[model samples]
Target: MTGLSGSGKSTAGRLLAQRLGRPLFDIDVLIEQHYGERIPTIFAHHGEEYFRDLESRILERTIQQTDSAIIVTGGGIVIRSENRQLMATHGVRIYMQVDPQISLERLRAQIASEEQQGKRPELRPMLAGPDPLANLLTMQATRESWYQEAEYLCVTNGRPVEHVVQEIIDMIEPTRNENEHAASLIGTPELSEPSTSDPVIPPIIRHVHIGDGYDTIVEWGGLSHIAEHLQRLSLPPRVFLITDSNIHDFYAPMLVARLRAAQFEPHVYTIPAGEASKSQRQLNAIYDWLVDQHAERREALIALGGGVVGDLVGFAAATYLRGVPLIQIPTSLLAQVDSAIGGKTGINHAKGKNLIGAFYHPRLVLADPLVLLSLQTRSRTEGWAEIVKYGIILDAELFALLEAHAEALREFSPASKALFCQIIARCIDLKVTIIEEDEREQGRRAILNYGHTAGHALENASGYGEWLHGEAVSLGMVVAARLAQKAGLYASEDVERQNNLLTALGLPTTYHGTVSAQDILSRMQLDKKVVGKRVHWIMPERIGQVRSMTLPDELVTQVVTEFFGAEEDHSHA
Candidate 1:
């Protein structure tokens, strides 16, 4: 059944397939393991535009080849008009709806429990810097409407797994009969009201084709995988390890050891920490470092550190020698969740963060949670903000896990170490599932940007250093929730609950006094989220759903006023 992300799309789809003895098809999972690298890495490498085109083409092909199977789509699949039309033509569409609160609680529980499982990696994209629940609330607002377009609606509120499965089974019986009749009546030009009462959903399917997912992971084995994948030429063996000072102390040695173990020669280069390192000066230094290392086109560049380092090194690798193979070894939580997985690499421009970057998909991404162990608490928590985002936008169970174990999560308590890994892995799995289906983000992948619209605006307006990315995002989520409330998508109580959770986590619901609403709005205009020069916001509806909307300029301003005035805190970010 299709619905919002945490509404149990994957679980229900699997259950129905099992009970009915039909093949279960999860487009996201199908592509998860195929890529050697992460989907976000590819986006960073190939650019969103290129990724979208690739995603659309792949989706078109996949749908055409599949038979009668149970399909679980990404939350934003309905946003692409073409995909929706295809679904209506090719298969039965059903929405498995759940209460937003339930969905949110489920997500938090999923992530928190996973951390206890030891199979989890790191909690990357599921939290807001210090606050996670607020981000979830914001995410719910951003994707609610897009999820309402399903053909069949099945409420999953307070229901057991078997009960939900049976309900879907019951719906399918009538839907199938309806489909058969519709086929026979397809050519009729005129129809009576009774005959037209139930319309047949289309089933035109599309398969998104992405290059081998395996090739995306260059750092995993130096050039071993690439050597086997594309065995055209063998050049002199050399390696460039590009990272920041902080990461150099953490992961560079591990990467260097791996390369050496693989019989490849490698060298390391280090930059300072934070956003400033991603500048022309740093890029030039990297070029010089490459020259000193005798790096060549055939050699691989290993990027180790957080997002800033990855962007800097990846861009250098993309432009150096016209293009060198780049691999990613992300150290920080943020890099692992958002930056490391996607191929969009670049440093911050004076005008905006990440304004100048290349879509240079990495050869591969090797994520080792061991590297994250070295992170300071603030840095660790910074990544949690993004982790909370994954649940808010789609996965309800993950949200629940965060809520259940917020205290342990905040401190990365020893008892919760395993939970951390599972949380990270789950988020990775969720993201990979979406990226595999819509690598270019022409359709399903945009759901991943659940809180980024306002988050980016805050970052740009306040200057890159003003607030941690996750911190701004935490506040952005609050503002988005307020906007959703104003739009009447959910009750004001939902917004208050969000603010309370954030306040408890030490994350602000409003911006610091230095940032003005107009400045943020102006910077928002420069956000890449703008379509046709119109800023599209991902607003919340309830606790577990969100949808996109293009707010009027005045409305946005009013919302901003409410956001800043929503609380009386005047602390710095």
Candidate 2:
């Protein structure tokens, strides 16, 4: 099913999926679940390049893997040549048509209804501004020919969803020849049976979407089968695998060997590991390496490390000689759960972390939890800060789940794959929700920085190497909860619950670094989230809720001072 927004694709598709008793793979929902964000958020954060890339990837995967299912796609899915081709070759295609004006009206009604229910509905960014009807018409003009290419077209304006769905059902099963129709519905060509002499071919991949699209791919041994996956993608044969030294020793050689076995030209480059590697110097080195290898726009750069490598290589992919395709293979817990998804790429400055960057998303992200086994306890434990942030600011259930599994998770137990995967997927989902709301950190996205306002400052003041980003955030969340309490916005008991979770997760709940409150304050003023010379503080009203506001600098200082531990010698740090 395909159509402009408000054309009732979702409405009709739901009925069709039920009638057929098949799963519904609504592209919009799949994109949201896979990317862990919404269409508008993807647009606001990653831009058209990133969104289209994901859209195409998801469309292809949906078509390739499905035997029989209702696959509803966004109208703009036709914008790309690959998408048009993928749909053309597969499915009993149906285009749901509606008047642009009607579409616009339905959208407004949806927005109004969603708001009334306190739901965060997604809008097609292309057709969401003033003169939306004009935008819709313009989009229709661009996509009309493609929409017309579908095998069947059903007008949806003024018609009931059941009527439209039945009409589609009739088209799908013209003579009531149930067997033949079922065969077509399930995409069985049945042209001819190949003899045993025929060459063996790989079957369609089961692409498991975690968030945006690349979330669950790692659990399926996506790394072990990287070569096979690459063979199926449209990327160039020349691949660049970039990682930090700390990561290179663990997985780079194996990945390189596989790529070579598959006849791909893999150029491996290793940078010094740590946050410091996310710098202009390292970025320049990547550029030089790409040039030395005569990298072209068709070439893909694989970021095979944690957030530092993901951010640095992602930026290089975003701007090196214009742009190149990027594939994120995040090996760290933090990178997999937060950094790798949503395409927030950048480098840090001497003054602050991630002060320079772009919203260039990766073409694909492969997260293998098995790889996290390589992380030390400190590295593994810090990622919980971000995960816990999700529960604290948006999802109370996730927080409770973490509490239930706190001890096991802290131990990184290999026995809890299902639990771990669910936690990871849910965390990515919440992150996407925020990006959909405000990817630029102007409004809803600010909530994502619940602990980051002070966290980033503390990270900088203590020196980047002093504390892991997640540990700093864990402490920041604790302080913010306390701040809310002092400001009469929250109860002290809830603050303790939030704090106790972090402590149980093996995260830091207090600061004892050499950095002073004054130093932290000075750094806070320089945070990217600052608005009109005032830093925005995201304080919790309670678990699963947060509000953005500015607290008095004096009060902020007092809270930090209260939580401060005895000055510890950190020269080693």
Candidate 3:
């Protein structure tokens, strides 16, 4: 058991062990018994480093000695990565959670009561500060990520010790039985079969091994494998699933059932289904829900819808508790190809799209193509716009592939699963390579925003919900092609090919909205991509080649004016 001091880790572990008929090994008690001194005394005599090293050694010995024992560790045990790995590897790690304020209050009350009884308990070294509650909060913030590494999280605040123990037992019993059953089947014929179905082969998972942090996985029908993936990653069993109403209506029940089967406790939070949901109000509501659920850092915030849900929930996961584990289960084609793969999380400000956000990566991205089968035609076509952007900005082969199967893709027939998966994987591969080179979008990754400058501007000017992100991007790509043509940087035939392809895919090749060119220019100026008061335009030079240029305001205005068929205004110039 792991948690802040006075959060009942020791008490719960003891009771749980008693109920399970297993030996209970409390690390703190063992350490105190072995040293013949209190923890505070040890900390005072030997530095914290010394105590931690001794604690690690004792913990290792304890684990090696008893294979079936409930081990209660020091709250700071997870602070050491090796200690976390050991606990995760050896047993079912459970986190006893409580609000910092409540835990601190409990500790203070315990100390006062003990003193009144004429038996003063040893004061915790961490709680020695003038403001113990503040110290606890600070410590919790620092170690929250580590504590979140536990597989199970149980809230102990305002709950009886027995209730908390029962929660832990309920979480662990199924896993225990499964483990025993596996042990019994070690040499049986059933054990010889593969763990997953044949269609869900492991090799189908496209792993993005980028950097020291988490990698990404893109696979067909990957949603069914979410439980196994979570177990393998050792993510906490609790999930805060964030989805839009539409996606929740379709996918929530199935996903919840699957998660339950995997012994996961999932809580669903549904927002309205549209870009309108990606706002400050919805974000605050999500934060409130997280707090109400007593969400811990180790638990996951699973974004289970399109880009709107992904962006909203991803930003919430990034900021709430200073960040928690994120799992992106992108259902829309647009998200599977682009938005979900990148770590860009945000909400639209009044002036611009994705103005308030962070670059927090998800622990996992599960893009199941099967979900796209039920997608509306408009959503599917909107997604093609991004998929086409991938082809134009990075891979000519992908461009040609889409061109060859443009009609079939539009139909989105059941027989087109392989083609859809191929397209999704290729797009993800291109994105992963770019993200690996520039994780924070400081340089090379900007190419991925091929048409986003004008695209975002259009979305903002049209009041976000007027056009799907893909639709705006589709028109934005057309504007970009025209700009490239006017600059004489790209061949006219290539621009024509782009137009033809988009038209064939039933994507927008023009925008007839009321937003004036000036309004769009103003919105573009507020874009995150603007550098030195100039918008960075991604111009396609050819099928697979693109370049970024800081075009003059007048030139961009003229191009956008032509697209909107509006009179160009030169007041700013």
Top TM-score prediction, candidate number: 3
lDDT (10s digit) by residue, model 1, range 130-185: 76555545655665565566556788653434346655555545444457622221
Cα misplacement distance, residue 268 of candidate 2 (Å): 0.3
Ranking by lDDT: 3, 2, 1
Q: Which stretches of candidate 3 lie over 4 Å from their true place?
A: 1-203, 567-573
Model 2, 114-183: lDDT tens digits are 4433477777785568777888999888889889988889998645343465567656654235554345
Q: What's the CA RMSD for each of the models?
A: 24.3, 22.6, 20.0
Better candidate number, 1 or 3, judged by lDDT: 3
TM-score winner, 1 or 2: 2
If scored against the real structure, what TM-score would every candidate get? Answer: 0.58, 0.62, 0.64
Residue 60 in candidate 2, Cα distance off native in Å: 59
**Residues forming the 10-long window of minimal summed lDDT in candidate 1:** 200-209
Q: By TM-score, how accurate is candidate 1?
A: 0.58
> What overall lDDT, based on C-alpha atoms, would model 2 receive against the true structure?
0.76
Q: Candidates ranked by TM-score, best first? A: 3, 2, 1
